[model samples]
Target: MFINVSDESITVNNKWERAELAQIEEISMYPVALIGDVLQRLGMMASVIRHVAGKATFFGTVLPILTWEGDNLAIHRALDDAQPGDVLVINGNGEINRALFGDLLGEVCLARKVAAVVIDGAVRDIQELDAMGLPTYARAVNPAGPSKYGPGQVGFPVACGHIVCNPGDAIFGDRDGIIVIDRRLVSSLAAKLKLQDDVENNFRARVRASLG
Candidate 1:
């Protein structure tokens, strides 16, 4: 699912219509657990990836980074190009032999005010990443570093964590797991998620009363 190409400037477009802040905040208020339920058990990323740092909850429009396995130069470009409200949903093709990101990159992302990072591959420096206090999720961690050698793409449609990621799709994550929502679906889904949460809450309250 990955290929190595000579180093060159990636031509993938940088700008895409992102979800609104109001939508993002509303969605973030709901637990991923509830959102997962409302989504009809959809948009879940591969379960192999787990939270390894910072606040367990993170939500933002996806900024996908597609790279050859074990390579990270494109990630640098992504960091440089990322805006404050982006979540870097990276596709390293599930390569685990080399760690594609680590503490150094984590610091840059935090400084840039990025919302979070989700790597569908290996990362390193778990302690430092946690210390930096930014959300990060990855498939695995290794001490081995990545090759900065190029041949990767950024801001493109990519598949990661067993699901397809479109640039600007909304990404939501927490201690429970990660969920992706199509940008166009945000308004509708947010309303549905709230309704579902209310329904579940009422049901749970009723159960408690019956037991009493």
Candidate 2:
């Protein structure tokens, strides 16, 4: 289901199944660190939401933008409504006035088996989230409150960094940066990314050996 609120789109899908084909493609094929390398190659700042701690990696489908006056109503709605392996993309418009997300939300997401949370605004309770091992990427962190007013959407196309995120697009983020692969291109991109990772690792190994 999708909720359209003016400029925002929120998607709610209780069904959670990693696309079998995608999973097969991932498993049968050798893994590559393509997403990380892609960011470095592009010389773009489309990665490393940088606000998270611990194993701050993220990859999954997008549940588009949601709005709140510092209250987490829509966010909660999204949670109760998110499919497993879905990434929650909150468009806070880069607002740093208050904390857009916190430990409680993080806990809920973890419990629901959600993949990650990406916000263009702010998040708080970093210590708890990190302890819980929840993956979150955001512009900043603040200790402010949120509103629970109207005006939020789900299952729509939203913009993050320099990429346009649509529902089901593959979003992968690591230390290097975030890579959004079009759902249609996952198979091809996966192969290319895996190749890139192998080549890069071989180069790194050779360089290390020569230094020794």
Q: What is the C-alpha RMSD of each candidate to the true structure, in Å?
A: 3.6, 5.1
Predicted candidate 2 versus true structure: per-residue lDDT over 111-188, tens digit per residue: 888888888778888888889887888888888878655466566666666567776766666665555655665656
Model 1 over residues 28-127: C-alpha lDDT tens digits?
Answer: 9998888888888888987898997777888998889998889898888777678888999999989989999898888888888989989989999989
Candidate 1 TM-score over all chains jointly: 0.93
Report the Cα lDDT for residue 190, model 2.
Answer: 57
List residue ranges in candidate 1 displaced over 4 A. Answer: 1-9
Winning candidate number (lDDT): 1
Which structure among the candidates has the greatest TM-score? 1
Clashes of each: 0, 15
Segments of candidate 2 deviating more than 4 angstroms: 1-33, 36-48, 68-71, 205-212
Task: Give Cα-based local distance difference scores for all models.
Answer: 0.86, 0.64
Task: Output the worst ten-in-a-row residue range by lDDT, candidate 1.
Answer: 1-10
Error of 2 at 130 (Å): 1.3
